[model samples]
Target: MHTSKLIKDTPTDRIFLFVLYIFIGLAVLIVLYPLIYIISASVSSPLAVNSGKMWLWPVGFNLDGYKVILQYGDIWRGYMMTIFYTISGTMVSLFITIPCAYAISRRDFAGKKWFTNFMLITMFLSGGLIPTYLLVRNLGMLNTVWAIIIPNAVSVYNIIVTKSFFQSTIPWEMQEAAKVDGASDFQIFFRIVLPLSAPIIAVMALFYGVGQWNDYFNSLVYLQNKNLYPLQMVLRQILVLQDMQQGSATGSTISQSAAQAAFSKEQLVAVIKYGVMIVSSLPVIMVYPLLQRYFVKGVLIGSLKG
Candidate 1:
């Protein structure tokens, strides 16, 4: 694979590769710059951010933004709720998705094709938001944790990926061997197939966990109780409505209050905005690397063959 070992590229090929590298480098900058700016802005003084002093690095660095955010009792409650939802949701999704996928992958399973088609149809078509809401309400799931977890317990896309992975990675020979040993289908699945499916399981866990963590729409529709709000919803309230209100109140006071207090208020909001962005995204960023090794392998193996 080394360039020195490979045959020399033609002039046209060289030029194409050079252009491709430049394009890729530009794309990286486009994506990376915003992340760097957010981090820098979060740590910078509010005045520095408001005055456009921060670019690549924090200016007049301070932790006041984080200090203010941590002081909010609602944020802590939201954090706990999000953690509970993510853990519980991922467990439920995996238990349902994995076993169902394994079953559909089995060639001997009766009506597997019909089941797959039914799942696919549901993927493309759903009762609209109103009907779905009414069902949840009638089921008494509204304002409950199940409202967020049960309705989205299984993703058709995940099932497809996992089924494809099982088909490609686990062969019929293994199942035949297990059967020769007098193992039932459930025993083979639980003892043998599950052990070999670590990579796909990790990938599904990451996907489902991130979805649960980032979900606010479900909470918005089903949860009228502020106590049940997830971290994303709490951050949305802080970054959107609360920030606007704070800015307006500060602007009104600016005309009557001392110059220092007015300046501090403006800068504080600027810092808090960036800080909130970082806080909201930090958990996903931290969790991704733990499962990254399995992610590419799972997606490629699951998709390439099927």
Candidate 2:
């Protein structure tokens, strides 16, 4: 028979905890409200959204926004394109980033300091837009699939994080042991290092995937074919075209039927914008939960080690 003693909080500790909870609760509300509002607005009727009647929850709940988005044909093509970009680009990034980070993290790797310093210089200084554009053009990457994929493949920050994770988390003794067993460096890396690197890999994948998914500037600058445009660019074009139509309608005289059609289109666009927001963010939100465990562990350990 053992009795467990309860520890009571002192007044100072209690007061500190109370204030801390309040601040934490406020922070949560600040972050959570926008997400809730976006969801609510996406479901609410266009009139309710535009009229400001929809606040914290849906007002005059409707699903036509989603219907209109579904009917929009280009969005599907853009989705396929975006998915391809995210998957392929992430693979390319991981392939380059992982090997480079591992090599740089190794103490025996020759000229590591020089290589790291050269890479670091890129973080602050770079050729201006014209020079970069010319370089890409000279390489004939412009207007090609590789235009976006190759140019933004390696992230220096990701490399640093992964390097720190490898240096601190992976034991140098383990590598030595593997080497003594008559395993070559390549074999040891392929067999041991990669297998234990899932957390950092997942974090890198999330970062690179999200960046590729949301990327539109590269498409705008380098891509010529409308068919090559990703989901973000497609959405932007839709919004721009709608605005143009509205401007034309307002500036020019139109018949009753035309006016009615324009007004109906306006309402559809209003709701569709919010629906698009939900649809665009849905993939990332779904992915985050899957990677949450790895993300937390990787970022924490990597950051702490650095």
What do the candidate models score in CA lDDT, each in turn? 0.85, 0.83
Q: Give the top-scoring candidate (TM-score).
A: 1
Model 1 error, position 125 (Å): 1.4
Q: Write the residue-wise lDDT of candidate 2 on 69-143 in tens digits.
A: 675667898999999999999999999999999999998999999999999999999998899889999999999
RMSD of each: 3.9, 3.7
Clashing pairs in 1: none
Q: Residue by residue across 1-306, what tens digits does model 1's lDDT show?
A: 655666889999999999999999999999999999999998887777888878878888777777667766778899999999999999999999999999999988999999999999998899999999999999999999999999988999999999998998899899999999999988999899999998889889988998999999999899989899999998888776563476643233422232443445556766777888899899888877877877787668666554
| lDDT score of residue 123 within candidate 1 | 84
Model 1 residue 57 CA deviation (Å) reads 2.0
Query: Candidate 2, which segments miss by more than 4 Å at Cα?
Result: 1-6, 242-263
What's the lDDT of the predicted structure labeled candidate 2? 0.83
Top of the candidates by lDDT: 1
- RMSD of candidate 1 to the true fold? 3.9
